[model samples]
Target chain A: MSIQIWTFILVGITFAIYLSIAWMSRVRDTRGFYVAGGGVPALANGMATAADWMSAASFISMAGLISFMGYTGCVYLMGWTGGYVLLALLLAPYLRKFGKFTVPDFVGDRYYSDGARVVALVCAIFASLTYVAGQMRGVGIVFSRFLEVDVNTGVIIGMIIVFIYAGLGGMKGITWTQVAQYCVLILAFLIPAVAISIKITGHFIPQIGFGGVISEGANAGRYLLDTLNAISADLGFDQYTQAFGPNSKSMLDVAAITLALMVGTAGLPHVIIRFYTVPSVKAARLSAGYALLFIAILYTTAPSVAVFARYNMIDTLNNVAYEQAPSWFKNWEKTGLIAWVDKNGDGKMEYRAGKAIEGKPKLTGQTGIYGQALVSNKVVDSNANELYVDRDIMVLANPEIADLPAWVIALVAAGGLAAALSTASGLLLVIASSISHDLYYRIINRSASEKQRLLLGRIMIGVAVCAAGYFGINPPGFVAQVVAFAFGLAASSFFPILVLGIFWKRASKEGAITGMVLGIGFTMLYIIQTKFLGVGNWFFGISPEGIGTVGMILNFAATVLVSLVTKAPPQDIQDMVESIRTPRGAGLATDH
Target chain B: MENQDRLKEYWRRNLRLMLVLLAIWAVVSYGFSIVFVQALNKIHLGGFPLGFWFAQQGSIYTFVGLIFVYVWRMRRLDREYDVHE
Candidate 1:
């Protein structure tokens, strides 16, 4: 009857489904292991791509981030979704025609250089590892809350689950599991959002309800955005719909960040790899459309959920005594992610614009006078703010804040796990494939048998999972910063080269290798300088988050310039480029 | 030689179509959503400010539409060039 029980039931059921799919789909050959025999339906591949693309960040974090950020959060919404257009138009279909097992395969063959293949795979591994670490942490957070386990134990459990499917079935297993995950995660996101929408605005459609007038609140009869704007301003925060507010990002930064993410999304190895599962060039194009449509359902609803979460947070928390606070607040507080300091000694929590405590909540593992979590953080001398809620709590605690059913809360837990686990397996598969397929077989053993390749692939997955799990528990200082730059890295590293390889016939091995090294190098150096050395915003006032666009530009320039000066590619290679331009004669994903 | 010319013409048409679509993509996302957001926010679409809606919702819808459109047009282009699989 309780939320915890419901979480166990839902998560147990979903995990059973995933493990069974993995068992049934296990493959013996390198082609089937890597590309699911290149026979997945467009509709199914679309669902898998949706699940793969929307990681822990999209499911658990984006809505909360948007809640805190207001309109400027558009950088993520547009940046992430817009990349599918580039993928559908410029990348996916042609790559499908090239018909290889990995992005590195295309790079190696097209550029006619093993060096280019190694460079691209290295970038792919680096970016994916950073992204997977974030997912493992998301899994840890969900399990820590619902299963009552420690974060490290939750990560170990997640690593084991991912290893089973990814190690055994490889891409064949991951694709099917992701399809199920897409369904579970999307439903989990929508049910709470739709219910909260109906409660507040009496509108079932969240997007339209977002504009509907509040139904039964103090701000009743006023439009939802207007009401949120009033609440935000009254709390000394910017208006809810305030575009480019003073506390928010500048216009150029928003644009640059969006461009980086869009380009980066298309370039991400895991996402592009999903196209290989499908049957044809046309399926690849159509699947991208379906992927975006499915992704849009969650993306559009996120902003609406952001509004409702902020509105409900203010309605339930501010001015309520700590003992009188909603049960969810008390429960979340035990996790130490949500804390309150009674600045005025009134025993009440006040949600305001300024910091509630210095630095972050330092839990003393003891209860305060009012039974609130006792944190050692010094109360800020500046303001009356008394709440220090982690932004992540916005989505997880939304149902509880609005008094939704326990089943929905449990569904949220399962959904978050589904999101985190699905993407982690996808990334792990890529890492394993890079080693077994690219590094070992292609580079080291051209005569390796299918059995040997499959064995190596399965073994590398276990290693990747352990490495990812360790990083999840002891996340590096750069975990959050590196994620943004991972996108920049992908943008700088892969997008330009892949596009040039397809569209430009003259692109040589020398040109691709040089562009890849310099472009990725420039982006990496900028990220390190700004993120690590604290040298902030040196290039045209763009921060590390937006520097990928500059890196991409440099890559395009370098590739084109170098290619023009160098000898043209061989005549046969030129004809190969011309041949891939047509959609006919698509091959199953395999090496020659 | 004739086949080469047809291939060139097909590639040219594809490039031309892509240019048009990408231009729309840039205009909506960069031009309206980012650069001219403030000006557009003065206009409202239902409950959402026009630019904010584009940033949050409209651009995503347009992206989905653009992809399907490309699929349909490209499929036809393939047929026209006798290149359909």
Candidate 2:
């Protein structure tokens, strides 16, 4: 069977499963919609959180990016996972004890100000919407690549599927579907990884395969990482096993990026909200641990897959004739993700160091003399590096690159859609509830009844889905530019305030407002200056990507300093913090 | 007043435990993984350099363990303070 047909069947089956789960778990009341009635089991909540946290980026792009980044990839691997430690210890339990519906709810009530809530609501919306747009774009790309549909059609299909389950079931529906998604994506990711691992190193466990010696070919008896290093060095590229390789980011910058991502993960409103669905503080704690465990299943495997995929691509494609290039090469070439410019016009493809084209390949809908796609971009004046591979293709084309079955390739398509849709729904709920629960119900219509609130929440979900889909289809160029900064903004604005609100009794609304404004404000200024305006890195050589670390530090310092000068929070609010400190008497999340 | 004293003590104990655990977390990730990585990489863990393993793989597993340990210790602390729910 063709990969396309198999994709249709697998994707069709997965869609059916998600829609059915949504139907069965359909929610009507606002509590059910917002926090799944606060009765979810810890293990299931863990699974849901994993699905919610692992977006299209995690499934489709991380390994690809890591493959090229080599040992420097630890920034993402550790940065993303370490945040759960902060979440489990410093955030989740207290937030659960406080029993709030949104991060804004906790912020507003704890700070004793509606103004603080509004600020938090805006930040939550800004960050979640930016992240959701990327997920929708990912959905569209996956559909276009696998289902053979146009990108916009694929996006519409994705939006419709999301509307069915997400609009119908809300959090209740979304949670169950995410459990199913976590299963599909993990299996899809693992099966190919395990298969390729055995083929290359005779090891079934990818973590073991990571260091396992190559079992075949001339490189047999060599460690996989060692083999990759030799090949990369031979190509005038940095060794894969070495840190701070010639092309790698500075260690200080890598540490800063990792710290930003770590705190940013903990502060994300969508991820934190998942803890509220569990029944107790204990459940919240357990669920967080389980969440990390489930996420680690994929996170640990990714580096190994990076090693195998990197080794295979270079080994097969280098010095091969263009016409006789591997089938995966030709297939991915048509998609315009991997281009061969044949700079020397020798009819041979050379995979070496340096850029082949001046910039990204622009297809003119023309074929070259060797029947390869003609790139309109100018060939760079450098070495015989004739290939340009998109980072996204590393995971997407892995099955084909390793000659896995058509079914496995189709399974990957299903898995990619599951990842994108689950994250989109989770982020949509945050945007919807931020507007409906926080803005409309709390501020605009305090006298509104349950039915009105529920209706507004559902309507807001519809609006958010459309908004996300629109941005997905016509992503403002800044959508991509601003996406990385979502974490920075979250780290700078949200993390400090939330932490201070819980741990420090004297933290005031004035202090939180000041902290958020100064922290996020400075971070944004630095990013716009360096990233957009091309200002030189003025802060100790830290790029905009790592400036969030500085922003986070400034937030903590400013919040504390402002609090010291300001009046202490009332004794009642201090007592509230004391109560949130313990695990006893936690209950269902409430708006009040 | 007596109940208040107990709550304060429980909170104090919790803070101390958290401090100890977060310290380990920082040492493994920031200490061994980043700051002292060059020194640690000289030591090998089978096929992996120790620092690289800590940075990428080991830190994640330790994070999971830390959360569970917090859960277990906090559970006992809850019982000790008669605050178990």
> Which tens-of-lDDT digit does each residue in A403-477 have in candidate 2?
799999999999999999999999999999999999988888899999988888888999999999999999988
Worst 10 residues of 1 chain A by lDDT: A583-592
Which 10 successive residues of model 2 chain B have the least lDDT summed? B44-53
Model 1 pairs whose backbones collide? none
Global fold similarity of model 1 (TM-score): 0.98
Q: How many backbone clashes does candidate 2 have?
A: 0
**Each prediction's Cα lDDT score?**
0.90, 0.90
- Residue range A1-592, candidate 1, lDDT tens digits: 9878888899999999999999999998888889988999999999999999999889999999998999888999999999999999899999999899999989999999899999988998999999999999999989998889999999999999999999888999999999999999999999999988998899999988988888996788988887788888999998978888878888888888999999999999999999998999989999999999999999999999998888888888899988888899888887777899888998888899999988868899988888888899888979878999788888888888768889999999999999999899999988888988988988999999888888989999999999999999999977988897779989999999999999999999898988888888899999899888889788887878888998999999999999999999999889899998998888687776
DockQ category of candidate 1: high
